[model samples]
Target: MRYQIGPDEPVDVAVVSAVSAAEECAPEALPQLTEAVNPDALNEIFAPKDEGPTRRSGTVSFDYSNSRVTIERNEYLTVEPLDVIPTP
Candidate 1:
């Protein structure tokens, strides 16, 4: 999910975890439900200094049985490099 932060925006980015409905609602195991979510899976993709309001797109994969989540691939919105400067 890509969100635009204004020029003077004050915000904090955080990584949490993925939750499964089957695991979260079990009455017997509350602590295990918390453990199933991996905090490391939450990653923050920050924009470069010269770039602002960048658009990022990516695919994510998750395996509930093994508790595995991987960011498959991603694309960044950028401008093409200029081969030569125009003469005014």
Candidate 2:
């Protein structure tokens, strides 16, 4: 599943929203956001800096709710199941 974050929306909210959607549950039903990553640190790392060009080309990945979550600096979030076995 892929989700887009609003220009002004906090990354943490986007993460929670993604996880909730993937798990078919409400955001509040999921584990604490901090368990996956520090919300403040995440925002600060991806937030536009005052000096130099804005960091717009990076990705952060972490495990959340039994899913692999990838957050892109371009405001895109992707969630995928982490423990799937392929059938040959």
List, residue by residue over 1-88, the lDDT tens digit for candidate 1.
2223343332111111222232333343324323544433423333233656554555444333323333322221111112232336
What TM-score does model 2 achieve against the real structure?
0.88
lDDT of 2 by residue, 52-85 (tens): 9889788999888778889998489998877772
Worst 10 residues of 1 by lDDT: 10-19
- In candidate 1, stretches whose alpha carbon ends up further than 4 angstroms from where it belongs are 1-18, 22-38, 45-51, 66-88
Question: In model 1, how large is the Cα lDDT of residue 45?
Answer: 34
- lDDT against the true structure, per candidate, is 0.31, 0.86
Question: Against the true structure, candidate 2 has what lDDT?
Answer: 0.86
Per-model clash counts, in order, read: 0, 0
Top TM-score prediction, candidate number: 2
Worst 10 residues of 2 by lDDT: 79-88
N/CA/C clash count, model 2? 0
